[model samples]
Target: MPEGPETHALADRLATLLVDERLTHVRFIDPGLQRRRALLERQRVLAVEARGKALLTAVAGGWTLYAHSHLFGFWRFVDDQDALPDGAPPRLVLATVRGVAALYAAPSISLWRTDELGAQPYLAKLGPDVLDPAVDARALLAHMRTPRFARRTLAVLLLDQGFAAGMGNYLRSEVLFQAKLSPHRALEDLATNERRRLANALLDVPRRAYRAKHDDALPPGKDYLARTRAQFGFEVFERKGDPCPRGDGRIVEDRLAGRRLYWCPGCQQ
Candidate 1:
């Protein structure tokens, strides 16, 4: 699954390809969406944004396209309609004067009225998107104090979208390690300073990952995401059994909240 940073990067790329550009053509594999194709055709994209793990593309004529590429869904871009990939059929396609963008295998693709977008089930449940520039540490700390979140273990709470939107597996381990707090620690048991540390890490780590993907210095190779992941360089994630970067302990791996987590128990005690 693409995490928050990856989702944001995708939104940015989609913005570059679609924003402010009128859709010369539009198609949807789903029949309901296909019937409403007139809502998108010839409509200019107002914006492309990432809300947690979802992508929202607002189009002209009071409609917003919502898509989430859970695990298998991916996107392909082509400069010409003739060059569009031929394999698996796309769930949605948007073409403009500049190029064509197709979303493949994504299950959650729908159109919502711009005015009623807030009532959309998924968007309504999301917490503050950490990657959102406006979400500061103080805001996160305040959200942390919510009654429900304060009692949950950090291991589970960090994965809660309602706790901190845009948080996922790699970030779960990275944030806990960066804060030097055990994942098993309950938020209610955290000291003031410790809570502040966790708040900082929650905001910092994902933004760092988002920044890593935007680096222009790296050459655009065949596998750009793999290259950026190397650049992001987690301190503890996926380094199980290897010596911790802090040198106090070896990284350990475990499954918590049904997701694999990597952390340095030595430094993260």
Candidate 2:
């Protein structure tokens, strides 16, 4: 799935290319959207913004192009007849006036009224986006402390967009592991310090992921994940069955919330 960082990166790139450009043409290749062609054609793009894992393209025509990659969807910008960038499969394509094309593939795509966007059932349902600078960590913490949220496991809660936006499977697993909270532990079962730690980690990880690329610069042969782990590489998540970076025990893998969660039980617990 394209997480918050990936989506934000796409929004940043697309914003640069599409913003202020008049739409020379708009094609609704998806059969489901063919009926809306009159509304989509020749609309100018005003801005592109991202909320959580969804992308919003504001059009001067008083509508917004809203899409979510859910799991396999993503977008690419090609200039002057350039080929689509190599990555996930594409399901939608939007070409612009500068001879640039904004390609969206394998992701759910939809168009809605700019005025009606806030009323969209899904947008209204989303929790605070972690990457949203306006998201108040303290406020979010207070919301989680409510009796209704107390019994939910941190792992499941993190994945719930209504709980906190911008967290996907990778962020959920990494945050819990970093905070040393068991996936099975409920929100109420966590100490105040633990909850704060988890929240802070959530804010930090996505920013780092957004700026850094996963590559060989990552420290070799270490298992312990610190705030510096991105610099050192990784603490857990994808390094399953490899040596524990913390030197406590080899990386252990288990299913939590129906998704694979990896950790050094000794280190994390």
Candidate 3:
């Protein structure tokens, strides 16, 4: 699944390419929104912004194009000379001055009133977006301390958009590994420092990813994983049965909240 960092990158790219450009055409292939013709056609793109893993393109008149690349969806910017890249043709395509911005295979795409967008059931339910530059860490900490989330497993809580938006399975595992927190740990069991560390990691990873792409350099390597791993990039998420990067013991695996969890049992606990 595309995570917050990936979505943020897409928003940045589209904002540069589409902002202020009149939308020459809007095509919607999804059956769910086939009837919204006037809503989808010939509007100027005012802005492109991201909320968690979702992308919103604000149109000149009054509508917003909301798309969530849940798991398999991806966007490609192709020049007129270029053909649509292989795989399924996009579900929606927006022609602009730069080229064609195609949204391929997205399961969720809709046209909505800009004023009513925040009140949508899905948007209303999401918690803070980690990739949001304005997210208040201290406020987030206060919210997590509330009774509603205190008893939940950290792994499960991370995946809940209502708890923290934009975290997918890979990020859930990677952030916990970075913080050295066990997936099974209860929210209430975390110390104040631990909570801050986890929150910082969530925000930091995405920013780093975006910078890594923009700068064209590899992102900073995880501290422990840099030394021992042969493959070179990953820290601990999928390195099960391999030597723990910390050398404390071999990597261990367990199931938590129905998703596979990986950690160095000695280093993490």
Candidate 4:
């Protein structure tokens, strides 16, 4: 699944290609969205933005096209040299004089009035977007102290979109590892300094990922003492049974929050 960083990068690329361009044609391969195709055609793209794992295309009218890639969806662009493929599923193709931007295999795509964007159920519940440059770590800390979140394990809270949108399985594991905190630790159990570290890591890790994806560099690893750049990426994610890069212990995996959680027993204490 493409996480927030990848989705953000996709939005940036799509904006570069489609912003300010009028949609010459709009094609919805998904049956659900087909009815709205006529309404989107010839609408100028005002901007393209990413929220969590979803993409939003603001059009000339008051409508914003929302598409969530979910687990297996993607967007592809094609020009004169590169041709659009045939038989892609649930694709919403937006074409202009320059080229075509086709969203393929996406699970959800629909139209929302711009005025109602704030009222959208999913958007309404999300916490501060970690990708937002102005995100307040103090505010996030306050939100976590609420009754609904105060007693949850870091494993669960880290993956909560309502706690911090844009966090996925890999990021949750890596952030905990970076903070040298165990996933089993509950938010209420953490000390002020520990909570500060966790909050900072939550914001820092994903923004690093956004930069790495956009700048074409490797995501920073959890092993802070790593000697070189090559050694400084993804300390615990997908490295189960492998020796910890931090040399504290072997990396291990467990299930948490309905997803795989990876950590090093020796280092993440």
Candidate 5:
């Protein structure tokens, strides 16, 4: 399944191709959405935004199209409708004069009144979007302090969408590794400084991923530690037995919350 950063990047690209451009055509394999296809055709795209792992496309009309590329869904971009990739029928398609965006295998597709989007179950349940520039460490720390999350192990809580909306398997492992907090550590057990460190890492790691995906070069005058850039290649994830960056021990892999994670017992403990 696509994580938050990947989905946000997809939104950025789709916005580049579709925003402000009128939809020359629209198609929906979903019978419910197909009836609403007329809502999109010939209407200008107001925006394409990512809410967690889902894409919400707003058109000139009152309609907002929502689609989540759950586990198997993926997107393809083509120069025009004639250039659309051949395969299984697309669950959704939004075509513009510049390009055509087709969503495939992504089963969740629906239309909604733009104002009522807050009622959508998935959007309503999401925690703060980590990639949103407005989200800061202090805010995340507050979320960490909530009892519903505070009582849980970082290993499991990190995977909970209500804890952090954009989080996924690879990101959970990387955030804990970057914070140098053992996955087994419970949120309430951390020292003051340790909690601060974890909060910063949660915001930093995912934003770095968004940057690496959009552009490797940092913005002018901003400086990031060398290791941060290095981690885009991955410090611990999928690198079992590799020497830890701290040079104290080898990285090890284990299952937590039924997903594989890698960490350095020497540094993380």
Candidate 6:
């Protein structure tokens, strides 16, 4: 599945090409979405925003188009002068005077009245968006401290959208590694300092991944590593059997929360 950062990147690209452009054509390959065609036709795109792993496109017509590229789904965009790829037709297509955007293999596409967007079931249940600059670190910590959350393992907790929206497999592993906390450990097992470190990493890791992906630069204060051209990139994710960055045990992988988690047990413990 494309996580929050990937979805954000896609939204950013689509915004640059689609915003302010009038929708000349709209097609929904899904029969259920055919009714929404009229809502966007001749309407101008006002903005494109990302919420967790979903993309929301606001239209001047007072409605928003929401697309969630669930597991195995993706998007493709072609400029006005360029030819769209020849292949299986995408599940959804939105055409503007400036460009064409198609969503392939995506499973969820809906149109909602702009004023009623907050009532959408998926958006309404999401926790604080980690990428939001105004996210309160303390509030995040408090949310995890509640009785319903305090006993869950960090691996499972991080994957919970109700705990922190935007975290996926890679983000969870990397963040826990940075926090030097074991994925098997529950919140109740953490010391005060460990909880503080984890609270900060939960916010920092995904934001860093977003910046590294979209901006080609490290997050502020992150330094470059000699091994990879990417700055402060993954220290343990997918580095199985390789030497740990901390210079102790080889990186290892194990199943946690139904996802493969990579970490250096030598340092993480």
Question: By lDDT, who's the top model here?
Answer: 1
Full-model lDDT for every candidate:
0.87, 0.72, 0.75, 0.79, 0.85, 0.82
Candidate 6 TM-score, true structure as reference: 0.90
Worst 10 residues of 3 by lDDT: 223-232
Q: State every prediction's TM-score relative to the real structure.
A: 0.93, 0.83, 0.85, 0.88, 0.93, 0.90
Which has the higher TM-score value, candidate number 4 or candidate number 5? 5
lDDT of 2 by residue, 8-103 (tens): 767776776778887666665687786786675677788888898888989887999888877655455666545766664346666676555545
Q: List the residue pairs that clash in candidate 5.
A: 231-234
- Backbone collision count in every prediction? 0, 8, 0, 0, 1, 0
lDDT of 4 by residue, 1-269 (tens): 87777787788888877789988878787677788776678888998888877788999878898888888887778883248765644377788888888877746877899888888778888888777666767977887778888788999988888988898889999999989899999888899888888888887777777776534443223233122223226878999999987887999999998999999989876
Q: Order the numbered candidates by lDDT, best leading.
A: 1, 5, 6, 4, 3, 2
TM-score preference between candidates 4 and 6, better one: 6
Pick out the ten consecutive residues of candidate 1 with the lowest summed lDDT.
219-228
Error of 4 at 152 (Å): 1.2
Across 95-154, the per-residue lDDT of candidate 1 in tens digits comes to: 988888998985699899999989988889988888887888899888887888878899
Residue pairs with backbone overlap in model 1: none
Structural RMSD, model 4: 4.8
Q: In candidate 5, what are the lDDT values of residues 154-189, reduced to their tens digit?
A: 999888888888999999989999899999998889
User: Can you give the lDDT of residue 59 in candidate 6?
Assistant: 95
What is every candidate's alpha-carbon RMSD to the true fold?
4.4, 6.0, 5.3, 4.8, 3.0, 4.1
Model 2 ranges with Cα > 4 A deviation: 81-91, 102-105, 213-232
